[model samples]
Target: MGEIRQRFTDEFKEQTVRYIQEQTKTIPQIAEELSIPAGTLQRWMSTHRKFENEPLLDREAIRQKDKQIHDQELEIEDLKEEIAILKKAMHIFSKERN
Candidate 1:
């Protein structure tokens, strides 16, 4: 009969990676404590490193969106000013015709 394989949740894997990053313990020591293979823990750390740049990407995207919103607001203000000028011109022409 084959031995059953153990499964771990993504949350558990992420927490383990974080613990490894925050501590000075050796990989073998942590693996012994957690009763998992050191290679498995190391693999998790490798995966975490790959995704770590995601936050930086997210911040850059947010900055671009904020800039877009600011530009749109300025455009709206300019349009409003143009509308006011047109209204004043209409008033002036109406009085000239009276």
Candidate 2:
């Protein structure tokens, strides 16, 4: 396999990660849209959790975080639904073939 190379600067990485965290899109979707690895964005987000001074999160920011959490929960539900559908389809197909 070829080595992976990074093309974006630190500012770009930070902005992309912040956008990913704040947006309604799933991590996979964000990665696909931004052309960055989901794992890389995920790791960046983990690192961001240790901010010493975040300028004191305002009520709006708190609301935004709540929204982000809700969005992630929805995404997880969607993924679970998709997995269930796939499993059901697979079982039916397997029975039909047997």
Candidate 3:
């Protein structure tokens, strides 16, 4: 009798790939631990290798970027308010001199 084929979900595959990437364990060791074939894990790793060189942003980094953007937006609003106030002041001064 032939062995039934096992299927894994995309989430499982992605977590497994991330684990393989982050762990110090060898592929064979991880495969054995997970009861999956080394070849399957290797194939997943190979597919992920394409984006391995790209920098992945962690949650903290993303949060910091978001804060920076928010701060910049506030600064922009403040500058716009200052510009309007300066323009109003210039108009008042010109009227007084006229």
Candidate 4:
């Protein structure tokens, strides 16, 4: 006789995937703890958590990356302004030196 299979809810699958994401353990380890097939857990993660095979970053992670880029842009602009000021100062000092 074959063993019976169990079904899991969508919410439960999502939470399991999330737990996998937020923890340090391997998929097999988590699956073993939860008594689910590792392949089933991997499929749940890949299907529910990815887009076209690429993992999607969370909204807060995207926001933080955007903020980091914005800060770097501001820093570049500030450096450009400082360089322009320094060039003008050098021009003035060179004229006085002549």
Candidate 5:
């Protein structure tokens, strides 16, 4: 009888790819840890060889990048506000002197 197929998520694949690329252990070791057959992991890596060079971003990495962008935007806004306030204070001081 043929073995039943299993579906893995993009995140899982990404993580697995990342793990494999890390080279901390052999493919068999990682496959054992992930509860997948060694051949299956080998096939996945081979099938996605193109992406191995330019790794597919997993959800967590994308989220962290988004959060970084948001934080930078907030910081820019705060700096702009501080600049505006300084300008106002300078204008007021100049008017009082004049």
Candidate 6:
């Protein structure tokens, strides 16, 4: 008899990580259930964490940036409305004079 080979996909890896994080099961327990070695699973988790890139902007930084952008957009809209009002006033005044 020949040994069978197994293939794991990206989704499988992600699901395993999620299970490890979210479930109360021990690493060995999960490994046994998945038919992987405990050490290999541990290495997989370490690799996943190590490869995760620290975002250039963290969550708080992103929130601040979004707020700044929203404020700038509001200011621009206000300026545009002011310009329209000024143009209307000038048109009315010129019409009165002529």
Best by TM-score: 4
Task: Measure candidate 1: CA RMSD.
Answer: 11.3
Task: List the candidates' TM-scores in order.
Answer: 0.48, 0.44, 0.49, 0.50, 0.42, 0.42
lDDT tens digits, residue span 1-98, model 1: 99888999988898888777665578899999999999999998888644442333357778998999999999999999999999999998889553
Segments in model 1 whose C-alpha atoms lie over 4 Å from true places: 50-98
The whole-model lDDT of each prediction reads: 0.83, 0.77, 0.84, 0.83, 0.80, 0.77
Candidate 6 regions exceeding 4 Å error are: 50-98
RMSD of each: 11.3, 14.1, 10.8, 10.3, 12.3, 11.4
Of candidate 3, the 10-residue stretch with the lowest lDDT total is: 48-57
Cα lDDT tens digits for candidate 3, 10-96: 778887888887776789999999999999999988775444533434788789989999999999999999999999999988885
Model 3 C-alpha lDDT versus the unseen true structure: 0.84
User: Please, what are the lDDT tens digits per residue for candidate 2 over residues 1-98?
Assistant: 99879777777777776676566667899889877788988887776543533343378978999999999999999999999999999998888452
Off by over 4 Å in 2: 49-98
**Worst 10-residue lDDT window, candidate 5:** 48-57
List, residue by residue over 1-98, the lDDT tens digit for candidate 4.
99999988999887777777777577899889999999999999987773333333578878898999999999999999999999999998889552
Query: Would you give me the overall lDDT of model 2?
Result: 0.77
Q: lDDT per residue, candidate 6, 48-86, as tens digits?
A: 543343343357878998999999999999999999999
Q: Which ten contiguous residues of candidate 1 have the minimum total lDDT?
A: 49-58
How well does model 6 score by local distance difference test? 0.77
Most accurate candidate by lDDT: 3
Separate clash counts for every candidate = 0, 0, 0, 0, 0, 0
Pairs with backbone N, CA or C atoms under 3 Å apart (clashes), candidate 5: none
Model 4 misses residue 85 by how many Å? 31
